[model samples]
Target: MIKDKPIFSVKNVCIDFKVGGKNILSKRSVLRALNDITFDLYKGETLAIVGESGCGKSTICRTAMRFHSPTQGEMTFEGKNIHKLKKDELKNYRQKAQMVFQDPFSSLNPLHSIYYHLERPMKLYHNFSKTERIEKMNEYLELVGLVPAKEQGEKYPHELSGGQRQRAYLARVLSVGADIVFADEPTSMLDVSIRLGILNMMNDLKHKLGKSFIYITHDIATARYVSDRIIVLYAGHMVEWGDVNKVIINPRHPYTKLLIAAAADPEREGKVELPIVRNQESEVTVWTPDSKGCPFRLRCPVAKSECAEEFVNAKQVSENQFIRCIHD
Candidate 1:
């Protein structure tokens, strides 16, 4: 069961990337990828970050994994500052936190067998004898539903189907003894029939192994299926966040409503017309660093004059829900 205390916390985080110089002699311009993002991941629970492409969903995973450092704010893992960890502390931190990439095919080494992939992490993190390692490897493979574990071990990455490859990745995560896993679109590439199985495995890992998870995806339906909490990101800003069911059932942010609407059944009759909130020019530059008001005002149907005058902070709308709109 998940406790009330947070296992991981990201506070007032901001990330900017230097794209290119405007001209030969001009200084390089910066693009803000994330702005003032804050959230927490509790033990044995999954926190899903949901948004459309380029909305900073993956950036949250990257920042949390320390693949990229933020320009502002701090991240803490079990009360320790993540960015300020010493060399040994950093190494130990890496062992505790692992990532499951979006593409299973690209994540694994095509040249190596499944056994080799699982063995390497165990070799780095534990002092298991060859016999013990072999036993544990087979155990984890079986745990992930890869039956006939010994036979699966000898097969190379290319020999497995997409679902099998993803299962191997999950087994590898277990081998490393990761307390937290950042799953970046882990099922996007798999067949629809197999996606739920991968998700169910993740749920099992959370409950059975006491592992915390951050599941990033563009699909709200999947996010709702697997997460305890859901955060809606738009143009690097958090628009709506709360318990997954609360936010999904009573979406307060305009952008979030549009997202839910967009994900609704397309073939159903009496389809609600998605509001066109942005002009052509506004659509071109989705990320605006100089905007004084809400980052989503440009696309919010109910935005007012005050929304254009200053940025709004998140306010508690219910016992477990928060919205970043002044009107809410």
Candidate 2:
């Protein structure tokens, strides 16, 4: 279904972290984690945030879920400011927006049985009776392809495989009646053979149950497979964002092009890490954050004097597609 209304709207959101000891704390010790990020998340669509490890991908997810308050700007969920919500309201909002953490093993409670894990949410959120909770838990557990529900229910997390644990994590999200799932590298730790299974399950969850997913990952190939739209982030800034196919086939930003090329290399017989290209001095990686120019000017191959100016408009390359670079 095409959602005319965006489930979540992030407007010029910026986050900062204070470094150094309490005694050493100073105004100069602030580190900008996110710099004026703005985006819209449509209902039931899988939007992938792809970036390198330190590029603020997870920070965006955490901030969107209201795990931390933003230093600047705001995030609206269902037309309400998430940051301003009080205890009761925030708890209610937390139920709607649940997180599937990166490590499946770490996320699941090792001591609790699978049934205990799923049933607790149903009991807490929906207040289902013992009988009803058990029944509903089985339904969701089986929905994620966890067979022999009776036997699996009694088993602890350590008893299950990695894929099984991941499925259990998905089942947990369903148990809470989560409308939006912020899956931060959900399958990054799984075996290569089983990663697709988890991704396929996420796809099925979106299509069948109509759940919106914010998939955060560095693997662009997996992002392309699972996301309807892909956002490319670099050094805490969004360089490119749009349809997955459009961005992959025709990358507009140099950073995006490099990311795509590194993730998927048709020229190579087998997958290999793309060589890192430097900008001028090899000793230091430079960023022109204060310059009135494109954010990617340092690493851009086609850099020019004109590119040293701010990009006010994102060009419409095609329907449902836009790019921020004037050089594009």
Candidate 3:
């Protein structure tokens, strides 16, 4: 199903942030949010970006949506550079690419009813007649499992439960006719019971509707459940990537194994995984834009002396496993 040229692609994209420019005394510092990150999203495919906190999972989504221009490299949708698009072209790009934010509470306007939130996108993109917009809104709300669609559509976002608000947001994205949806941990705030339902709904949307999805999350389990492919990030560096199950079951990168080990399954009551120890010297060498060698060398348990000498290149260790590390 992932055949043909990619629908969206990020090639060697790097993003840098200028922090602290408020006063003359406060010198601006460069924080690299992404480093030569690259990946492709095919139609009907789900690509998951996974890492611990601050590993730049959310940054990738922002870059693809053109919220932040890349300091280096490029992002393209249907072969056109997003960073260089004109205002009109950019508006069209916005309609085609939609985002489901992490926070359900603030994502919807408190002032507007849920119907208004859903109808706005329909009117903006589809030029739907007043009656048509109402009918479509009801259909979408029902699609997301909000039954008695007409009644549910009229409630304010605050009136809905946290789960319902998320469903409404999903309906809004569908209402706009977006081809790609960037889900930035959309179900992280909900209860465990509710999370499963949301995941099922997203799965239905992906396979049934053939929408491209970029699912960003720190939860490795969910990443495996939702994504066809997985890319693991560490301190802004792409440490590992390939088929989701392959990487999850047999992680090659030291940082990746550490992350998986942390997400132990209590269901496997007697199963055990060894702890990954950190190199003490690495604790003192903080990773920065200018850090030499592998960005993870300092903390990597298997790091060798040569690992600190030059930039590390990613290698294909198995059929689908690509890892960036000094040692095999």
Candidate 4:
């Protein structure tokens, strides 16, 4: 297998939202959605971001797509800084990277037909003739397994089932010639049995088409199934990241272990011990520039007094395995 280079690289990327507050002493404050997040997306591989709901998985996806600008750090695409791209350049970059949103029904336009949805991007980016655009639309529909494209294209978003609507979304991405797909909980809203089908399609796309993907989900099992590498995020910081099998079988971080513990094994009939849940908001007293320590220290079961100091950077405990835990 060819070791394809990183098509997208995010270096210490930070995203902060200015939330409103009331108090004479309070200045306009920012909520750090993503804190010093650094990761790379290699070609033809899936890098799954697994975390709880407010850990900023979606923010990372949005930042990479240029939908949300980072407050700090640099994002590079094909070795060029994406944050500095001009309007036309950004538009061209967007054409190559597409997002498959969680809710299939909400992603598509209720008023437009599937054909119109697929045709719009092709028309906007490529200077194809009407006949060429229509032909390409049919080809994309077929590529996403929405065959009999001529008839399916005429149906509206509501006319299709959840899985079908998601397939339509994939067709739109294919229509635009996108090589990287950022799928944010793509199967969360679908029926449990059909979720694997969507994941299998993504796996096929990666192997068959050499397309890269970022699969974001809270489900650890799905991450292991669909991703080559897994990144475990907690409260806006990466706790552990490495090869999927390594992390799943031998989790290092407290949070990662908690997640693995929570997930029940389908092969085993009886229920397993549930993982302990942490209060996200109470995990830390504050994010102080003066403070230096592991971000997960407050919630870590094995925290020592030494953990109160600045936590050390991630260490490679084994080949292809890295965890940002002092205990590890």
Candidate number that wins on lDDT, 1 or 4: 1
lDDT per residue for candidate 4 within 99-166, as digits (tens), equals 99999989999999999999998888889999999888988788777879999999999989999999
Best by lDDT: 1
* Residue 107 of model 1, lDDT score: 90
In order, candidate lDDTs are: 0.89, 0.82, 0.87, 0.85
* lDDT (C-alpha) at residue 298 in model 2: 63
Q: How much does candidate 3 score in TM-score?
A: 0.94
- Candidate 4 to truth, TM: 0.91
Lowest lDDT block of 10, candidate 3: 278-287
- Error (Å) of candidate 4 at residue 110 is 1.3
- Residue 72, candidate 1: Cα error in Å is 0.7
Model 2's alpha-carbon lDDT is: 0.82
Candidate 2 scores a C-alpha RMSD against the true structure in Å of 2.8
Q: Tell me how candidate 1 scores on lDDT.
A: 0.89
lDDT of 3 by residue, 122-229 (tens): 878887789888888998998899988988998898889999999999999999898899999999998888998888888889898888899999899999998899
Off by over 4 Å in 1: 22-27, 266-269, 284-289
Arranged by TM-score, best first = 1, 3, 4, 2
lDDT accuracy of residue 14 in candidate 3: 83
Segments of candidate 4 deviating more than 4 angstroms: 1-4, 22-27, 268-271, 274-291
Residue-wise C-alpha lDDT for candidate 2, range 1-328, written one tens digit per residue? 3579899888888788766556645333566677778888888899999988777899998897777798888999888899998888888888899999888888988889998889888877897778888888888888898988788878899999999999998998999999899999988889999999999999999999989999999899888899999888876777788898998888877778777777755666866655455646532322333435565666666667776667546676766666777765
